[model samples]
Target chain A: MSAKKLLVGIFDDDHTLIHAIEHIRHDGYKVGEVFTPFPVHGLEHALGLRPTKLHTAGFMFGATGTTFALSFITWVSTLSYPNNFGGKPFFSLPSWIPITFEMTVLFAAWGMTLSFYYLCKLYPGKQPKIVDPRTTDHLFSMTFDLDGKDEAYIEKLSSLLKAQGAIEVYIKEL
Target chain B: MSHFESPLREPLITGNKTWKKITDDIVVNTTGDIKPLWLIATLISAAVAAFGVFCIGWEVCYGIGTWGANKTVGWAWDITNFVWWIGIGHAGTLISAILLLFRQKWRTGVNRAAEAMTIFAVVCAGLFPVFHMGRVWDAFFIFPLPNTRGPLWQNFNSPLLWDVFAISTYFSVSLLFWYTGLVPDFGTIRDQAKPGSIRWKIYNVLSFGWVGEAKHWERWESLSLILAGLSTPLVLSVHTIVSFDFATSIVPGWHTTILPPYFVAGAIFSGFAMVLTLMLVARKVMNLEDYITIAHVESMNKILLLTGSMVGTAYLTELFVAWYSGSMYEQYAFANRALGPLAWSYWTMMFCNLIFPQFFWSKKLRRSIAFTFFTSIVVNIGMWFERFVIIVTSLYRDYLPSSWIDYRPTWVEVGIYVGTGGIFMTLFLLFSRFFPVVAIAEVKSILKISGDQARAEQWDEVKDDDVYKTLEK
Candidate 1:
């Protein structure tokens, strides 16, 4: 990937950040990514991001767990080596419910979380690409790729950001 | 930028709190210097934990004979502590998962610490059964993995094996949920720490390189919601399986179908009490009264009242069923519990688990920190006795008068029990000192909508009529 020039705008409040993203997008300048100290309501919609499908992944994983648990337990109790337990049936479904349910939840939670980490490129000791450190503290930030934009265009975007209540605006190479 | 909240709803966060203030107040507990009081407490807890460990070592080396269990009472204090500790763990998941799904905003104040309590409680709980196996080295025999000895498989129909799966699943899932929530808060601390310092590096790795990007937060929120959905039922099932351990047995008192719901309610009751016991001391010691306010205390006390009532009702129902069923053995079991040699323990469980929590019915007592703290401890003790009453009383005097005998825990057993307490405290203290005790990011998210200053300042911005007008449109 080629290094790119980026325009970054930092705001002190979540509301201001949301408003800035709206105005920036309305002006037809492509918004790259925005970061905040905490999840800001309505900010994703303002950035035109789609809702995540992580829950679908969770469902699939849970289904896999259920199937695996039922089959394994059934195989172990019946085909592999069946013993007369309380003179009950070989495949006792009620007794197997608890383990199956637990396996379902276990798979769904861990699988979804690991998938999330994979999608987000998040892992222990991985260095984050931080535009502004304050974005994780008290500030909200919006970044725009200006890879092929002229100085005049950059100036116009910076002025728009200021007008939209940006606390600070600057340029950086990423 | 603005959202609707009923004016009558009390602020979840008290005092004027900004994002910066929230970060400083919570993060300082971890990033700043450790307090002398915390050090002293840790030392004491560590010492207790060490003694507990030595007791375990003695039991392992000398065999399970070191315990007080005999022919009549195969399970006494060890199993009692196991059920008690596991029950205490329920509150954390309940607060984190169930309350989150219900949109009870008050949970944000206590969820993080409560979830940590869940993890530590499970750890302490897991020790009993493992050590009770006598040959701790052969504990792997519990698992159904293929082995050299005849390839003997565990009985899938057994409740004990179900407990192995249930508890292990509960522990791992709770850990994931807790650590997932911690990632953003760790990011906040990582940003606050001096760059390239040890604190910074440690927090950075712990945070898993979270940068709080909008897309990442969106995904984070999704993951949390799904985890909460999974944990709600998982938490309930854990206790249900625990109850199955007894209910599936043919013992008169143990064979009742009411065991599942009774155990779950009792677990939640005990769990909430433990959370209150810890949070009350923690908020005071950490000077976090603003975040974990009286409203939070009252909310928790209300739950204690509800679950306490459920437990009380279960106790009464058990007695009624015992008599109403007209089964002589069952009737005899209930009679023996109430009027037999171990009647004191039975009454203690009733008073502590049932009667003491009823004081919360009074609004004043419910909100009083001193009363809540005292009742919290009382409820915990009561819960321990509930298990004791259920296990020992039922076992010691079963159908056979020839084998009837009294059960008592030897010093080694008691030491191990006390040792688990030490271990729990040690883990909790270390957590509070080194980790953000409160979910800082979550607190910040709710600050605008439910904070005292935010509400007071925005009081005139949107009228209730205007909100209604918008709704009408």
Candidate 2:
């Protein structure tokens, strides 16, 4: 049940925190993950995080939303039993364009939001680990995923945290 | 803990009155004028709104002819003012929603009040159409009604119907978005308020049952994210649909395809301008320099520059499309807007929409509160003229020379527009007097972000203690 994992060291500035998420392809021990309370301008590349694909998800959700919207209106106006108004033909798609467009956008936003929620696992019944109570008020945190490392190595990681200007350090199991 | 490190700093606004003192003061202490300025302003606005209501009432009683709009100008002041106010609503949502999405921290101070402006502006907007039906009593005819006497379903085929859905959805959702953001801030007011008074009751009801719990923060953050996402496109769609009411038609100048994007752009442009106008006054009147920093105003001014340029681009696009489409009528309509008898309005529009915002690109002008304030008002005037030119110039110079008539808004139409101003300010005054002008929780979050650098230092010390006492094996 207890498996040794990567021992990653994190260091950061006061009034900020860092997770040393640096990889160790052939490591005895190394830094792994870091978090800062506020975005540190150059930190993304430091963490080796890939550029976010949120916009891509946004566009897909938007497109699917648009189709779902356009089609639904089309269905209702034409096939859902149409009442011909102002002598306009049944299934007048142009007339439906505004609503369809609105719907597409609505759905895209709704879908994207849900996807974001799902990704973050941000709904009920789950209590988020309070890395620090002041994280909500005034604190930053840095975390590292330990991988198959010795206890002494973890101590070394903790020492590295102190040396790197970390104001505080704590182990967190994710 | 260091004296400077105390998180329990006294709130900026506090009540000196105790439970009974507050009640007695509220009930009997009517002498001193702490808010007499707001009171006078509210009364004036209410008066104007009442007069405007009368004008609308007359328009309903007699018909659309009670106003200056005639058959040849089937769409006139009513339509123009409708678009103008809805355009005003855009600023609130834009200030709050889009800026929030971009993580523009400065938005927190002004967004709450700006959103109230949006809701009130939309209410003002919904009025014109409701009364413009010539038969105001039959206004509900626009809705999907089950009628006894020819109970007619809504015309789904009409772009106007789409407008109905768009505007109402926008109003309701914006209200929800605005209100949801206010709950915790209202709770702050409720907790901080003196007990057993109207202020207490008011804030308590408005806040619902918000607790400053972490779980609530999680839900709060997500819901805000979702609402912002919804509102971003809703902001675009509301005005786009409004434009569709004109673009989908075969009317000479109105049928242009460039409208939806142009309208949306113009909406945002005007909206930012209005936000600046209101915020400038609010900061001055309420002395909210700390809460609404100069940096926030500068950021808002910058947005005005960007969105105003977008609107300018739209104006140019309209001219280009008129020429490129090879339609002589469309070309003529464009020409009439500039060269016709009412050409001054067109030029004014160009100056306000295009030139005024350029001042903002200057770092000095953007930061100069005085200049930005004037420019904001100028931008609003330009947006109003933009509507007037669209509605008036094109219609006045229509195909039939016989129908060519110089149009002037009668007292009724002018009075009504002025009256809507009353309605807007009245509601806005009530809002400013009652609500907490900023989202406290959100502000706290931003402050945390600001102070993150300090806590980062303490974290190391904590880790050292953990390693020595707990981690030693």
Candidate 3:
């Protein structure tokens, strides 16, 4: 979303791409984004991205499920259509544990996954704008915004990427 | 960053695997021409499934009487199959969730297919309870829906109701977890497909437009960890709740405190067996030996041995408890199971589940694919009999002497059971053909760490000081 004109560099390996990112950033050039086929360990730290808060969101969703299940079961057993089964108490908490735990898992899993998809803009029909198709296969790619830069700056960055072991370098409007 | 793996540990992915090679090996199964063997297997399974469908339809049209459920032996093959299938499903979640929590790297090879098996098994498991309702049309009565007739709610205390919630939730969460894992792999396939082609279009949609950005992968990893955490207990609780269906009852054999843990162990035992049965065939048929190597098979066999021993211990414990309680009724139930008319099934369960898996204690047998496959099937048969022996033996002879009656499954009942087997195979064959049976991306992630060639290289470059420095960093 930053710019249509991008300087894209593709690396054949994740380790090289990670080192390239650190070197590029160390040299005072802002790396736009790196795309990979799989999750490369330590790549996020190399990119200076914040740790994901998905787990926090999962906790909240699980809590929501617990509250809903408990309150719903209690209300059903007590106020609404209460029935004495084998002379047991109206609101039996021990008996409610299984369903409550199930609801907690159900809501947490579904809620966290849906929220993840939302945050990542992943949906059934979304046509992804990929920098390089190989990024999802065997390649790791990094893009740099070239909209405001002059040709000299682009040349310097391209050479730097090549020196840092970029297998391919190109300019593309995406 | 370099990965540090012990040189002594067996590589998870054998062969000199690179990312492209891994993709080609797995993706070709989906994108390339279908093998004649797969097509034939699919056709046979489909035909069986069709006959099963016809039997179920016939039962639905006529009545529950089409099955062999009389006054005494009320729940025979139906509940047995349900519990058996549900138990079989446990292996998938265990491999995906529990192994993941423990950081077991070998799971990557079999997790995808195992998870798929879980979904299919649950689907097969669900059919029994729904159709067992007899009037299948009134299946909704199980749900605690707000009703107009006195707003009658399902009894909250009933384990049956808990079962309803547990099974449905288990199915849904497993589906979510499986689909979530599949997304990135779909992206791998989509990226390889020819642009604007139908294969590309389909995979593109299935992938949910995964671009594999670092941030997205970060979230993906986080989500996977949390889901694994949630599913760990969820999987355990599902079988526990299922056991509660019988454990909560007042019947002699069914009413026992050991049922939950015993059932869970047996479930995992049978589930791993099923996984072995499927994966051994899949690896051979799909030519995925490099991914699903003997090490994977041996590891799974180890699990079967452990869970099998646990189940054996449970069987012995149940008998001991029955004898120690000094309750004649409980003693009678255990005695009836072993020496009664249905003792054949009970002994079959003991031999298959308890005695057969003991063979896995031998390393030579455990590592042998052929032997492992044989024992896996035996274990599943044993588990089915275990369920059958518990459900029928306990129910057939009630407290009243007049209620004692032998039960036999009608042709329809046998047909449905066979049909579910057909259905499971059909779905699995289709999944194997269409989807990446192995998780491509996850395998790739571990390639640098656990791949045979990658590890060899890492062993040379990795040093004690380097590992410590990396740790510090």
Candidate 4:
């Protein structure tokens, strides 16, 4: 599926990339993915991307962690073994605060990281579909799927990209 | 430009470097032959660490009897080192996680090194507590996992057990947070590496095929934010729990309600000191003076001063409460820390932590590299003594006067302490060799935000004038 030809527009700066993103979307072309050396502020809105739901996932993971920690402590201290230490109550809520807090953080960190990798389709030893190596350096690149677009429209898109300060444009297949 | 971006906002990466130059500057260290000084430093550190391991082996063979810890001072050096190393570990996360959350741009220059310090310090920290347990092989028993021993579930009510969970969680989460931040920097290096070279391939795998896709950056930003948020509280909790190990006990000096906040503040204070110590040496050795500028040093000095005063305040509060409460045990503990046999240590800590940092109130001393370097070392010593005072002075004299004993560390314990330093330096030196010491991507992100436009407006009226010339030092 990744073998399909991709039209990539390379911009010299993030400002030009933002302009090109707006221009390409306005010209009624389906904008695919844009790559930059860093997160260009407002590039998401420029591309009309929906807000990511990863934070929702993070909150859920954090909630689950808190519940699990409290439940495990309660079950183990009360139901499971019930050994008394220092004459404090078996379900010592104060002592439980540290572990509960630790668990919540542990779960959220791991959960959010794994969710990020999964959502981004990232894995160890995976081959990156790079349009240009410079995309990770200084150049900001936008890629378009050329599978269904007509040649004339593609040419128009290229000219539009050039007009918006694109350093170069190229076609490639991943 | 952010309204917050101004002359006061330090040019995080100095030299008004371009993205390519930033990448080039940092990647050079990773790709180059090991420098002679690095080799010497690493060798010395590795040797010290090896000696430490030998000491551990000796102690294991001879038993905990090898240490000077007696019945009265059961935790003299072992737990003291544990808390000390852990306290030193706090600065990295505070810089990487807390500073990131606050959007402190100056952090970009120093966070990479600080995070590396954190991982190494935690590794060093974890070593003491485990070895302090006489039965080193049975260390796994600290965890609550089911074992062959009948119905002996680890006590959930124990603060020691909470420490087991807290330190491990803190270590794991810190490692993740550190690695996550490294991904983009690693990707930058991978892209710059000679294609098909070993360096390229290694970074390629390490970078997880990161291509800096706008969407990936979006998710990356979210992950960083959430991790920072998570780590902010986690760093606080780890130290608070470490304090709980003492506070929950009935020991006079250990039982104060103020211990938690005091420990956390002291941890951050010490941690920053360690950061400055490593960073100052690092900036000089790695020729990163431009990247880690004087302003960066001054910024950290300000933090040291703030946290130092807080620590001093906590000290006075503890003393005040002890005196006001009329608890002879508490009063004796506070008084003994000052006028006791360990009076020298107490004064050293006070002078180093409280008096020394007061010099930072003068902006000149704060910005002076030599002064900052000296105080960073002094502050770390002060913090270590702070732990010693808390643990040893308190434990030295319990309720029973007859059981009082003066604790002195054996050679083996001293070796192990020195070994942890060796291990920390060895790991850090190796990290500096292999990893992007300055976060390339983050520095690049803020190059325009802080470095370029601010410097351009402040100096050069000509918009086209390259600002690098103005940064000539």
Candidate 5:
């Protein structure tokens, strides 16, 4: 990815950041992103973002796991090495319930976490670009793209951030 | 909504601490000098664990015959310890997963330590099954793999095989869940570390490059919720599978419909007790009384009370069903458990699992640290006896009266059991000494809600002078 200069606003409080998002958007300035130490309540609404549908992915994974477990057990019990186990039915659906249920959970938990990591672009060794270290500590940060913004407009945005109780406002290349 | 719900109920984290103060409070413990208690505790545990390792190594060399297990009492202390340890692991998932689903904020304080307990307990549990097999090296035979021993295949119909899959899956997923929760906290510790130092470098790698961006938080939130949903059922299922190891068998006491739920309740009861036992020690030793407040302790006591009653109900139901079914074998099994040579164990289980938790009904007792700590230890001991009563007593007298024989654990078996405690304590001590025992990020998330508002208000009334308040304001 090409490194680009971006305008960043660091708010001290979550409420101030939320208010900054609303005011900046109203002022016709696009609020690129807001970062916080914790998930600020209703920040998504302020930023106008969509709710996540990761649960849908989880459901699909769970269904796949259930099907795979059942079919595998059935195949193993019936065709692979079919034997009369205590004179029970070859495809004993009742006895297969435990493994079936467990597999569903196993696959879903593992599948959903991996997908979450992929979606978030997080892994073990990949160094992520951080806006500010204190974003993880106690600071709330908002980033705006400065691709084609004029210097005067940038000055206005920084002034607005200060007016909204920003702890610090600065620019970074990422 | 009121700013403070219960003024009397202690705030989870005491003190009007800032972000830096909290970081310093928890992280400094790791980097600072080890307390004398920590040193003594670690040394004792490690030494016991080493002795246990010696016992196990000796048993491994000699075979399973070194223990007191016999033809009649084929499954004894080893399996009992296995199930007990596995049961002890259940609360971690329940706290981390189920409580997350239910939106219990109090869990944020205890879940980190409990999850650590889960992983360590599972590690200890895993040792038993592997060693219990006379041929420890051939434990891989439990897996359903393509093999060439006369074109043999695994018995998929067997609950034993299901256990292999269940425990392994439980351990791995629990590790993931625990690690995922630790990431943000680890990142916090990393951020607080001195730049370019060993602490920073080590934490930097462990934190997985966490930046706490909102997008990452979004995914983190979703991942947590989804994992919680997945793990909720898993907590129940893991114990159910463990119970099936007995319930699926044809033995009279073992084969019962109530075993799954009964075992699940017992698992949670034991797990929570173990958490309390360890957390009580940690809270005292680490000076984290505010974070792990009395309310947290009482809340856990309530769970112990609830689960203990459920276990008691299961025990009664098993007895009622046994007598009502008019099955001679079932009746005999129940009778033998109470009146047989192992009657002391059965009574201990009854008293500890059923009778002791009744004291928690007293609000005074539930909140008292001494009472809570004592009960926690007793409950765990009771849970171990519960396993002993169930496994050994049932197996002691088989269908044939001629084959009836009393089983007593050899010193070797007792050493191994003690060794597991050593191993568990050693791991827990090391984990506490090095890692963040509390979920720092999660605790911060609830600061506005669950924090001590009295102190916050006190601090807030003078916000003009407080540097941290200026940032918040």
Candidate 6:
């Protein structure tokens, strides 16, 4: 008689939680989300999430930084005013290395961090949903939606979650 | 199920003493918990550091000639001290960077102290260059200025300028990295502080809104990873450019392309050895054996061996290249290094850096706490000699046969060198006393993840909360 269907399961470990997304999907259940306090490798693929394109953007930003840093130094040295000290030629490439290398790395790191934060919509003051505070110190979790249709099916699912070794269970709604 | 055993050792002192109790005990000498000998030694160091600062002030006022520098040895003790301090600074980055890359969790225990070492080392280094320029007030000459001189610019071609850039960058990056890591630890201290305490206010001001939120934990990891990556390169470039100071020059002993890699290796080698030396003593004195284990001591020894071998190999390659170059000056430079005025130091260096690490190949020596501790000290001594050999041996034998004059470091030079040890230790003591010598958060994390299949099974958290509750409560 309930209008909402519910699904429940647990995992042997966080690694299992990460891998279980595929199994849950293969069983013909919609995986509305996967939640973990800390990162578990391969959770993205398990949940059918798209690959991040931040690294590629980082490379572009780094190259731009390198070029910008080198060109500015060139402008400072050769075009702006050239002075020869100790008989060495002006606009020396080897000399520009420390600054250029520094800028490239600085740009790549900052660029990548900013891109990830922006793309992920992460900002200061945003209160993230926490299933367990212990995740920061030591816990991991995987959660999926259980909404719409069948009471007997929900009981069977909750029992299956316990069988998978859940220490505790709750009928959480959000 | 069988219970998992903790591999951690007990701290030297563990009890329910409050901060007030601890401070009262320290001031009143009610508890002879720490050895008097160690306390006396620390005080002596503090005294010498005070004297050293006075001398540095005198040098700044009267110029670098206050010591034994002349035209032939234009860069004497000043540059030597610079190299020494910078080389020592490498340990912090090594603990934070290379060990982090390897996922060596042992690093969290010692990283705070090592990072403090880096900051102090940089401070000592900055002092030398400031005074080395005769007109200390005009030290801005090293920087590229718009109107200091007609089109005045720092020579990009000069290794000195490179050093200026490298050290400044290394210092700034290191400061940022250390401060970022310290923020949360400051929070822990803030919570433990008594109400209205100065420490509480300081910690509160410094924590920067670190509420220990789970999401901030995620961001912290990302930020640390990026800092580690950036710091790795920054640390490498710093010592490499230091090598460039000698490498790009045409001087017989100074000029060699191998210098960069060799210097970086030696810097890390010496740095680790110094860290071990200080840590062993501190662990015993502070009663922190559990926090800093024998495993950590062994890991550092292994690194010492690897870097020592690398340095030895560099030494051999230098000798070979000198022979193969068919240049008589290069030949004499190598020959004089072993049999010259400071041949004793050269051999002492060889013995410490070359022969001692071979003992580490034996697990018995490496694992023996006493042996490893002594070996660490000896390796530090050897690394110092290696620097002395590289600086004095080459310069003592100049191109002009008549100009080949023997030089000896003055008592002032020796005093200042030893005094830096004082400054280093004093700062380290202050750091340990004031701050969390161990990264409490990271250690807590590592310990939590290490065991507990139940938590691993049910909670997606890497750690076991039951264990934390037991330990902390």
lDDT (10s digit) by residue, model 5, range B343-378: 888999999999999999999999999999899999
**lDDT, residue B378, model 5:** 94
Q: Which pairs, if any, clash in model 3?
A: none
Q: Count the backbone clashes (under 3 Å) in each candidate.
A: 0, 33, 0, 0, 0, 15
Q: A-chain TM-score per prediction?
A: 0.97, 0.70, 0.97, 0.95, 0.94, 0.74
TM-score: model 6 vs. ground truth: 0.75
| DockQ of the two-chain complex in candidate 6 | 0.09
* C-alpha DockQ of every model: 0.85, 0.08, 0.85, 0.79, 0.55, 0.09
Q: List residue ranges in candidate 3 displaced over 4 A.
A: A1-3, B458-473
Docking band of candidate 6: incorrect
lDDT of 6 by residue, B1-473 (tens): 22233423322123333223322322222122555675687688799898887776666666566678665666666677788788889999989977787777678778877888888888787777777777878888886667735665555667787787678767776776787677666655554555357755666666553445323445556667766877788789889989988988888988989999999999998888878878888777666665677667777889989999999999999999999999999999999888877789899999999988989998778778889878888887887778778877778667888777767667666666777778987887767666667666665544333323322333334136677547645
**How much of the true contact map at the interface does candidate 4 reproduce, as a fraction?**
0.86
Better of 3 and 4 by TM-score: 3
For model 6, the local distance difference test gives: 0.69
- Candidate 5 clashes: the total is 0
lDDT: worst 10-residue window of model 1 chain A:
A127-136
For model 4 chain B, where is the 10-residue window of minimal lDDT? B1-10
Which parts of model 1 have CA positions greater than 4 angstroms off?
A: A1-3, B458-473
Give the clashing residue pairs of candidate 1, or none: none
Candidate number with the higher DockQ (5 or 6): 5
Correct interface contacts retained, every candidate: 0.93, 0.13, 0.95, 0.86, 0.58, 0.09
The digit string of per-residue lDDT tens for model 2 on B1-473 reads 21122222212212322222222222222223558787888899999999999988877777777777875777788889899999989988887888889977667767888999999999999998888887777777776555675533555777888998788778877887887777656655554555446765565566554334323444456567667877888898899889988888776778988899889888888888888888788877765655666677887888888889988998988888888989989998988888888889999999999987988878998889889889989999999999998888878866888878888888889888999999998998877776656555565444433333323433444545645455434
Which regions in candidate 6 have their CA more than 4 angstroms from the true location?
A1-68, A85-88, A103-174, B1-43, B194-198, B449-473
Per-residue lDDT of model 6, residues A113-168, tens digit only? 56655654444443334343333223344444666546675666566556556545
Q: Please state every model's RMSD to the true fold in angstroms.
A: 2.7, 11.9, 3.2, 3.3, 4.8, 9.0
TM-score of each: 0.97, 0.72, 0.97, 0.96, 0.93, 0.75
